[model samples]
Target: MASVVLTACQEEEGAEEGETPEVSVVVSLAIFDDFARQLGGDRVDVPTLVPGGADPHTYEPGPSRVAELTKADLVIMNGLGLEAGLEDVIEENTPSSTPIVELAEGLPVIDGNPHLWLDVQNAIAYVEHIHDALVEIDPAGAEAYRANTDRYLAELQALDEEVAAAIDSIPSERRKLVTFHDAFPYLALRYGLEVVSVVVASPGKEPSAKDVANLVDAIVEEDVPAVFKEPQLNARILELAADDAGVEVCTLYSGTLDKKVDTYVKLMRFNAKELARCLG
Candidate 1:
């Protein structure tokens, strides 16, 4: 009976030793968390700083979030001035040795539009970066990360084609996007659309009366039919402005995802579909 109990205990210890350790990751936003999930699979445990539909621009990471960042083995951020509020927290909390992956690091980033994930091609590049960083942090899951990234990249490629075709259907003249901020320049430049006007240059900054008047004039001059607003932005002013200008108000996702359009691929597809419906 003593031998039998010892053997069972040994077997249990062996089983525990064979199980993989969970990799702790802290992502700036839910979108990065989604990418981490796709690449990390069961090997990683990711906690996001910004919740769903939360704007990374204006998000203030609390002490609890900073503590979480300090404990993470890997920290992934959108970069490009998107995480304005968490910059100091990331710098202070995250150790120098911790692998910090900026999804927009290698891409040709625009000044104001940190919504790089909105463009499918850009998202492919981000996935590659995320995959490499994950493999570096946890070599044991390298094969898994590579396989998952390959599959996810294929899906993103298909999404790219779909977005291209959808945008092609919209007439060039009708492709002008007027929005709350210059957040869609990458998307517009990628798909041959043009941004006509911006209510504000930076996130959380309301346009002055002069600026709004100028935008109103530009919208009238360009015959822009719609003014796009993100879910997190103050749409009341935009609605009143659009109403005053006789244009439609449409909502677009920037830096964050809605529950229905969660993944990067789905978000891009949704943007294209919405643009087609509103602008085309």
Candidate 2:
């Protein structure tokens, strides 16, 4: 509800009194919300369901949020189990005519991680699908959506190369990554980094003592340089694993974004740099 109110400011200051309102969109997470805004520009009302710095894995939408979803012209979701907490609400509330598009539909699914956008390649796919959906929903804005998609894809392509090169700079022996959860499989597969082990399988899930023990064994055996913690998840378990393994602990951003790194481009750049710092 707070997120809906925050993004509902579109009606406050603009235009003639009789202009047609933009198509309203409700996105399940912050990243998709940014994607809608960037591609739709002023032609779409994109209200992010999960607020910034929140975990989509555990975010529960309230009644007001369900109402917004019911009235939205489109509901965009990652659809790879990223928003497990909202499944019932989305199924029960979204109108039948409202088109619900899943950005991760055709992408390669990692075993347990649904963070496909972490890979710029997968993000390009997301942009293409979003462009198609936007064009289908708002034919009048087709030209604008195409232009924005082209420009954004170019930027993503450049970011892809930059991430590849930056990750390549790290020696092969140091390319192993250990993080709080299994959120980096796509990233590690896209880059050359190997996921040594993850402390937890998913966000908001606690690891068992046996799981932690096994992770510590892997970390110590692999001599992992660091165990990364995500901003949206509690880092205490990662801290325990790192301490047991005698390695450094660092931070990584996964499902959440802030003012400092709000967009997908900035978020990827920040993550690449942080990984390089930790592993290179």
Candidate 3:
């Protein structure tokens, strides 16, 4: 939720055709960092503020990270509240002339949820935004950025289709989600799955006894075969709830990445397969 407070940086046209511009970029999360890399290729240096396997909802940026931000040619974050921990620090330290772009700024938001990229279509939109931001800062590399963006967009379309097929494999009655946090609404909406229960509304919030009770009840009532716990967020509460409900717990990638899945595309494929295995 940071405003681009500084004056716009001067436009430059230096890189020749077929060569990539070397732009320093600081991204707030790993997923967005991957998106920038997919679009920028070898030209952009995307240093993620939040580390992999860490929950961005509760993550705080440190001094070393601030130093990176200060020198970054472009600063990018997922707006809507994903960078809640880094917003103030970035705004305070970034140069007035550099552009700080929020990848999710212009996309459709659902109930103010910051996990818009969970939907493949929304992720495509984010890549488009990244392309525009890259071009604006490096007009010389516009062709390169556009080519990279188009290629990644096509791959994203294939990913969307693949996810749809995987989800469709599950029986309609079992297409439901019980997750650690309210982070799967967009994904659920995309695949026609319902978010039956969640341990907490957002990261860092403690769940009440009633919340646990309701979650277990919903699991039983909905008859979902398995509940999901994100790799990055603590899921003890969710595990206990699932145990109480007598259903097995499975893994899902939400706000962050881990060893098994390091990139956004891998994360989506992992989710689709896990969902099918756990629910089909």
Candidate 3: segments with Cα more than 4 A from true spot: 1-21
For model 2, the local distance difference test gives 0.86
TM-score of each: 0.91, 0.91, 0.92
Candidate 2 per-residue C-alpha lDDT over 37-147 given as tens digits, one digit per residue, 9 for 90 to 100: 889887888878888888888999878878898788888998878889988888898899989898899877977468999889999999899899988888978998999
For each of the candidates, give the backbone clash count.
Answer: 0, 0, 0
Clashing pairs in 3: none
Best by TM-score: 3
> What do the candidate models score in CA lDDT, each in turn?
0.84, 0.86, 0.88
Instruction: Kindly list the per-residue Cα lDDT of model 1 for residues 1-280, writing each as its tens digit.
Output: 9999999999986676536647888999888888999988878888899888877888887778788887899999988888899888888889888988778877887764687777778888888998888888888678889999999889888889999899999888899998887788888888999888888877888678888788888888999979899877777767777888999999887777877878766778788888999988
* Candidate 2 residue spans exceeding 4 A from truth: 1-21
Worst 10 residues of 2 by lDDT: 12-21
State residue 167's C-alpha deviation in candidate 3, in Å: 0.1
Q: In candidate 3, residue 140 scores what lDDT? A: 74
**Residue lDDT tens for model 3, 1-280:** 1233332222222333235437988999899889999888878888889999888988997788888988888998889887788889889988998899987787778899989999999999888888888998888779888999999999999999999999999999999899998999999999889988888988888999999999999999989899999888778988998888899999989989877799999999999999999999
